[model samples]
Target: MRITRALGAALLTLGLAAAPAAADTPSPGPSDGKAPASAGTSFRTAAEIEQGQRATAGGSAGDYLYWSFPADTGQRPTVRATVKLPGTHAAETWRIDVYDGLRRRQSCQYGAQTRTAAAGASSVELACVLRTVRAWAEPWANDPLPGTYYIRLTAVGLPVLDRGLPVSAEVRVDAEDIGGPAAVDGSLAEPLVPGIATEDLADDDSRAVLFGLEPDDGWSSGWWSDRWVWTAAGGVLAALAGVAGYALTRGPGRPSRVPPGA
Candidate 1:
């Protein structure tokens, strides 16, 4: 009995020891499918690069431009944009237009329906908002060929700065489909702590999904973390230890007494 108890204790301790390692392993970060196309090349903003010198009156807010899938082609590209107006902005003065990379024509437009914003408050957001009046757009749907595109802003009708609307346009490419970006390997080699259900892991079609995109053929399909296998191994070790302990502490089953004939 004592031996059995000792063995059980040892196994429980080992199992407890292994658990910390499992917890320490980092999991994967959140992804929106698609891979890195150009070391973060796809997206840009007015302040992100050279400022456009062209100035005009009625410049909406501080000149900024963003792009996204103008039309949904199964996969929609998203961009981050922000706009700033001079002084106290008036209404309906700012306009951001997305142009096709090949055609160089208007693909889509994001216009402010309300009045201009204050110096500090003259910004609106769409999606992927990061500082400024960030918003998102898609030029891919406008049948944009794979190449650099253009974003233009017009403040021609609203207000202007002391030196015309100091309008600027910044642009960049956002996430692509799982196979588009090359940087992403599409693998969950990194474990999600505790235990993520197979269903949840399987449903993700992000860039990481490319890890198993190709048919497995004879090989196993779907993703399976090695962590679970390790845990099962630990369970087996514990069970063996318990059995060994029971055998060591157990006496003869009958508890034999002295023979009367002797």
Candidate 2:
């Protein structure tokens, strides 16, 4: 009975220790109830917004608007955009594209990523539902991962007359947890959010100064892949096997002396 109780206690301790890892990854909480008033025109100038916060901006019809937000592992993020186009006689086509921190374009699982507004139409709505962010992924794969994601909205096709026409855009990002089943065994060593050095912005007064340009070396997750671990393990095994093979195939050592046995 004592042994059984001890075993049960050990099991309970282990379960308690493992509970946090097995629990569902939590979704990012609400923002500070503030909305972004403007958007950026380039990646270097992309406006940063939080989940559940909406951003509204006005720009020319053909201009590109960029916004970014943070996403966590096991969450599927969806970006919704509305373009209130200026009065035009020709149909206009608009698109919303999402990119991970690496600037690699992420494919939408499902949403009207690209839509064409009919001539005389007042507005066009676009959305891109990104794949669930994974805790870790192969180095070569562009799977969504926890990081800063960018949303770029622009008119893909429009008449020349509408090029300089005033237009308004609204963008919002929403993320939902995929729950515990989406959890993976491993996680990134660090999120893909780029670290900006404050020293670089001390002198400049431009918008780029506020939001520093991409690092001179460029953005990287610096994530150590499982492949490296497997490769190292394989190398160790190969060395061991070589050592064993040499020991087994090499000439036998001299036999023990019979004189000492007597």
Candidate 3:
């Protein structure tokens, strides 16, 4: 009991000292997103941009804001925006959309698309997350890739009373690196080729390693590609047609069609 009491005193003393030290340390400010231009229309024309920087700007209710940020390979990109609605926008709704490097709309894997303030509230925040955007995603899949991404904010369904009022918002983008693919095993790896299916590289044959398939083999293994399956179906249909012809010509079990003129 005496030792436990002494240990508790030491822990209390350490916590008190750490509190002051932490308070003395300066915290970082949100200054990463900086617009390069005074005004712009699209992602390419976004004014300020930098990772983790919460750039802010003011505009009228109908104004639109765009921003861009870089998302590196093996990183999960995140975007967040807070809109301070004016008296006119209290009833108006707002949306935050994410786009890829080529200005394509990105799917929201893990975040809210719209953030609307309550009827009496004056502000709302929207958050978005792109889960594990593959660096070498399949060509058919429009998964987010490692490249410049864009965020677009707009106020929709503006009320008649809020057309002329001003509005403001803050936007911040981040690409947090969580780690690479699980198959990597934390080791050095070769470069990745986009659109190359990983399954094609699992085999050791030269065909699978080089071209991802054998020259004489087909990829489709389903019944739709089996010639024998279709042949049997055709034979069944032919038998049914022959029986129907025999039934109609024989007329009530007369002579079961013995060829020439029944």
In order of lDDT, best first, we have: 2, 3, 1
The residue ranges of model 2 lying beyond 4 angstroms of the native Cα positions read 1-29, 199-262
> Which lDDT tens digits does candidate 3 get at residues 37-98?
33245654665466656677787777778876655445577888887776534567788888
Q: What digit string (tens of lDDT, one per residue) describes model 1 on residues 124-215?
A: 43223111111122434333332233445444354443234443333333433221121111232221112112333555753332112111
Full ranking by TM-score: 2, 3, 1
Pairs that clash in candidate 3: 32-53, 33-53, 34-48, 34-49, 35-47, 35-48, 36-47
lDDT of each: 0.35, 0.74, 0.57
Off by over 4 Å in 3: 1-39, 182-262
By summed lDDT, the worst window of 10 consecutive residues in model 2 runs over: 208-217
Evaluate candidate 3 by giving its C-alpha RMSD to the native, one decimal: 25.0
Point out the higher-scoring one by TM-score: 2 or 3.
Answer: 2
Residue ranges of candidate 1 with Cα displaced over 4 Å: 1-75, 106-120, 126-142, 160-172, 178-262
What TM-score fits each model? 0.30, 0.67, 0.54
lDDT of candidate 1 at residue 63, scale 0 to 100:
32
